[model samples]
Structures are given as structure tokens and as C-alpha cells.
Target: MKGEHILPLSQSGSARNTHIEDHLDGSSAAIKVIVFGGLDGILTMFAVVSGCAGAAISPLQTICVTLGTLLASAFSMAYGEFISCKAERDYVESERLREEREVEEKPEMEKKEMLDIYTNRYKFSSADAHDLVELTFRNKDFFLRHMMAEELGILLTEDDMTPVKKGLVMFGSFCILGSFPLIGFIGNFLGESGSDTSRIIGFTTTALFSVIGAMSLGYFKGSYMRQRRMISALMMALNGVVVGFISYLSGLVLMTLFPEASI
Candidate 1:
């Protein structure tokens, strides 16, 4: 799964924060929703606004297009996440059942597999590996679960990867963080009508805001992923830049095709 993200089973944090999460039941999945949804919201709206401004599209049209895109994207993200998560859980369960059956029907084969894995993959001594496998196989359920977790990278608990929860978080966070770009437009409409600011100025300001949004996501990423703050921030900002430039080029190409539209 190229470009796909995998959540870790464990994350380190301050003792106080760990205790807080223990009580609150926080999931690393939430970090995915917040970081991705937040970044998408800010970046997409900013790009659309910048593109509309570049094309000299009317303010009213800009509002319509931006809002349309945001609303559609929000829905898509939420529903898509829900479906994907559900599918993932189903697939994992299906595989778990298959593994369970295999372990039950072919205990010796599985023991050998476990022994080989421990010895070859993990470099455990042959005697130790055999003993470990024997101990593990004492409980059928535990043996199956351990095999899946260790060999297949399955999350045994899956306490946090709820589809509905992830979907709602994605949609809600996207809406909340996505509104930043629109805030500027809203301010304009509330005051003296949105004046025709220079395209360069508008794009510059919008890009800066988008970069800030990206950095915010990156901060969350660093906190959750236990990575360096500056690197994550710069990487996110770089992604935003790529999106913005692509959008800008698209606008230019459209303007070139329909020269009269820019009129």
C-alpha cells in the first residue's frame, strides 16, 4: 500500500499525558484524522481561493466554488474513511479466522512456522525457539493471536480504530480547520465588499496561511509520531507548496484555454 499510513500499537508520551489518555481512551487514529483533515481543509480552500483570484473570477463565484469544493471534500473524506476502515477491519477479521483455522487444523505446521520465524527472522536459538513455540501453543487463542500480531502485523486489540469515530472526527476537524481560508473572504464580505486585491498579494497571503495550516498539522504529527518537530513541519509545508503550485498551474492553464473567461 504505497502512500498508505499505518498506526503504531504504542506511542510514548509524558506520564501525565499517558495517564490522561488511559482515562480518556484516546486513539492514535484520532491523530490521523486531525492531521490529515486539518491539512486538507486549509490547503484545499487556500488553493481554490488563490486559483479563483488568479482567474479573476467574481467574489460571489469564488465563494460558491470554494464552499462547494470544501463541502464535497469533507463528505468524501468522512465517508471514504468510514468505508475503508470498515473494509480493513473486515479483512483483518477474515484473515484472523483463516489463521485460527489453520492453527487448529495444522498445529504441527504452525509450530514449525513459529519456530522458523523465531530462529530465522528473530535470530532466537533453536532450542529457545522450540520452547517458545511450545509455550505459545499451549493456548490456542493466544497462539493464533500472537502469530497474527507478530508475523502479519495485525493489531490484536483494535480498541481505537473505530470507523464511525474516525469518520466523524475527519469530517468535523476538516470543517473546523478548513474555515480559516474562508475567514478572510468572510471578513471582506462583512466589511467593504471584497476588493480586487492584486492576485500576487492574494496568492501570497493565502499561501502563507496554508503553510501555517500545514505546520500546525506537522506539529500534531511530531507530537504523535515521536518525530523531530522542525522536519515534520517543513515536510508538511512542502506538501502544501506542491499543492498550491499545482493549483496555480491549473488555473493558468484554464485561463489560457478560455482567455475570455479572464475578462
Candidate 2:
């Protein structure tokens, strides 16, 4: 989502980095996580619900299957996210510890490395790079930070969310957004158990809900990423339609294979 900038020589790289960071700061990160989780939830549930509806299964059966899928998917998504994020955090910590030892044991070597980075990579004059490195070395923490960023290419910053928090967000988003398409299935509980009219209504409601959810996700994504909202919306809607159609076809195939299994 970022483009190359033609910056003047006078501009500091740190300033440009700060501006780039702003795009993902504040509510942006949470928004991103929520959108990601919500979209996954909606699409997955749509697949299941549409599949069941296409198979002409009993409402109770559809409800049972959808619920099972929803809970299973949510837990899976949350746990996977937690482990992935924790691993990343651990790796970063390991790097930090290694860098800390180098800073403490070989201060001069670290200083020279940082000086070379500034002079060569950042295009700082030799004298300026020397002064900057000298100034950084005055503070142990600052030196380590610069080493992490300049030498190791890892920027140290506090995250707004922890791994646990991210997982919880994913679980919540998946459960909530995924429930939308289930509404139609729930309607079957209101009418005669296996009536074709009720089943049709339920499937139609589920399809409508899926479309709305997909479009909403697309709109939010486009707005945050500064893309064309209409195009994004259409793209996401198309995905929903394709998934739903494929799911329906799969259900038809399954039904044909096991005619005796129809409830």
C-alpha cells in the first residue's frame, strides 16, 4: 500500500519512516485485524451455509453443522494467530538480546558498524556520520536501538496489541461476522421442519446477509487502504458469490452421490 517517494537529500530517513508508521498507528492496526478476521469469518460461514442449503438438508441439520463450523473455525483461527504472533515476538526478543550483548561487549565495533551504515546507506557525510555515531554511543539504549534498526534492519517499537489480544480479536471477529449468514438457517426453526418454502427463505436470507457482509468488508478495506471503494466492494462481493456458488455445486454433487442421505 506504499509507493516510492522522491525525497530531497536534506530529508532524514527517520522522518520518512515516522510518516509511514503513522498509517498503521492508532486505530489502523485494530481496524486491519478486525477486517481480516471478519472477512475470513464471513466467507467461511457462507461456504458452509450455502453448501447445506444447496443440499436441501433439514434446517436442524444445517443449524447444527453451521454452529459446529463457526466455533471450530473461530478457535482454530485464534489459536493459529496466537502461536504465529508469539513466535515473531520471541524471535525479535532473541535478536534484541544478542544485540544487547554485542553492544555491551564490543562497543567500538558496534559503533563503527553504525557509522558505516549512516555514511554508506543513509548518505550522511563522513564527519556527520562520525558525530552521529559518537552521539548514539553516549546512551547505551540509543546505541542498541540504532544497531537494531540500521545494522539488523529491525525497527524496535511497542505494539498496540499483544499476541493474546490479537487472538481474542480474531476469535471475536470470526464469531460475530460469521454468524450473519447463519441467520437464514435459524429461520427454519420458526416454520414447519422440512418445508421447501421455509428452506428457500432461509437460503435467500443467508445469501443476502453474505452479500452485505462481503460488501461491508470491502468498503472498510478500500477506505483504509485508500483504494477505489466501488471496485473493492464489487471485488469482495464477487468472491462471496463465487464461494457460495461453488459450495452449492459441491452440495449438489454430494446429494447426487448419496441420495439416501438427504433428510
Best by TM-score: 2
Span of 10 residues, lowest total lDDT, candidate 2: 1-10
Q: 35 in model 2: Cα distance from truth in Å?
A: 1.1
| Candidate 2 structure quality by residue, lDDT tens digits, 165-251 | 889999999999899888756764666566777778788888899889889889988988789998998899899999999999999
* Candidate 1: tens digits of C-alpha lDDT, residues 19-91: 6556434565677678888888888888888778667676668788889998999989999989988887777
List, in order, the clash count of every candidate structure: 0, 0
Model 2: how far is 21 from its true place, Å? 5.0
**lDDT at residue 98 of model 2 (Cα atoms):** 89
Model 1 has an lDDT value of 0.76
CA lDDT of every candidate? 0.76, 0.81
- What TM-score does each of the candidates earn? 0.81, 0.82
Q: Tell me the lDDT of model 1 at 40.
A: 83
Error of 1 at 4 (Å): 18
Q: Which regions in candidate 1 have their CA more than 4 angstroms from the true location?
A: 1-25, 123-125, 193-195, 198-205
